[model samples]
Target: MPSLRNYDLFISHAWKYNEEYYALENLLSSADMFKYRNYSVPIHDPVIDPNTKVGQEKLADLIEAQIRPVQCVLVIAGMYAAHRFWIDKEVAIAQSYNKPIIGVIPKGQLRVPESVKFAAHEMVRWNTDSIISAIRSRAL
Candidate 1:
């Protein structure tokens, strides 16, 4: 890919909790986000195929292909995020690639999952302004 205008954020979250998912979508799509995000959901959530070995192989290939495009990873620290397999997998991949990881705590919640605290390079609230401000603070 050509040099990106801003960072590409690979989002990892637990399927059990979707509030943070929508929260992130709003944050990244905002005009104020400064083209500082190219947010993508985890590979397992997208383009999954169980029809045949060939189809599965293709999806695996696609996932492998996408790994390079991720510059940063946002991990949504939901209640069950720490125990989810796919969430863990995504975090591991981000860590291996040395991507900047930001863990967001969804609204109406303050307690953080241990995984988020440990895996994230930084952590923030899910509110749009707070999230944006955290990004700005981290940049500085």
Candidate 2:
């Protein structure tokens, strides 16, 4: 059996919906089945201050660097994700890098973004088993 940590993953999410992101992270990290798995993000908390004005190209480059080494990209498929320009860019970068994209439908989410649906190589509901299966099955 391969450990979940064997696959490197980058999670693309909106800063405003970080609460859901943290919840997903906690679920993946604390689950008994994934206890030995290693799931990590390049940036611990990748929230840039709203007041901070960074160049779009520079930010994309920085995000690309984070996405480069990962084998998979996990996107939280909330409706708001479609509106976030950065998440779209992240998904594009992941595609450019040939990384597998996993769209995670957040618990209680009624709708998923089209961009997320289009980018996702696999879509999984918000459950440990489903998430782990998608990661293990789709990760490159």
TM-scores of the models, in the order given: 0.71, 0.83
- List of clashing residue pairs for candidate 2: 5-38
The number of residue pairs in model 1 that clash at the backbone is 0
Instruction: Give residue 43's lDDT in candidate 1 (0 to 100).
Output: 28
How big is the positional error of residue 26 in model 2, measured in Å on the Cα after superposition? 0.6
Q: Using alpha carbons, what is the TM-score of model 1?
A: 0.71
lDDT of 1 by residue, 1-140 (tens): 45535655566654456656766776677745356655454324444553577765674454445554766677788878867765676777667767777888877877888987998878888777766655555432
C-alpha lDDT of candidate 2 relative to the true structure = 0.79
In model 1, which residue pairs have backbone atoms overlapping below 3 Å? none
**lDDT for each residue of candidate 2 in 23-126, tens digit (9 for 90 to 100):** 87778777665432323343434454334566566677778888888878899898888789889989999999999999999888878999999999999999
lDDT of 1 at 105: 84
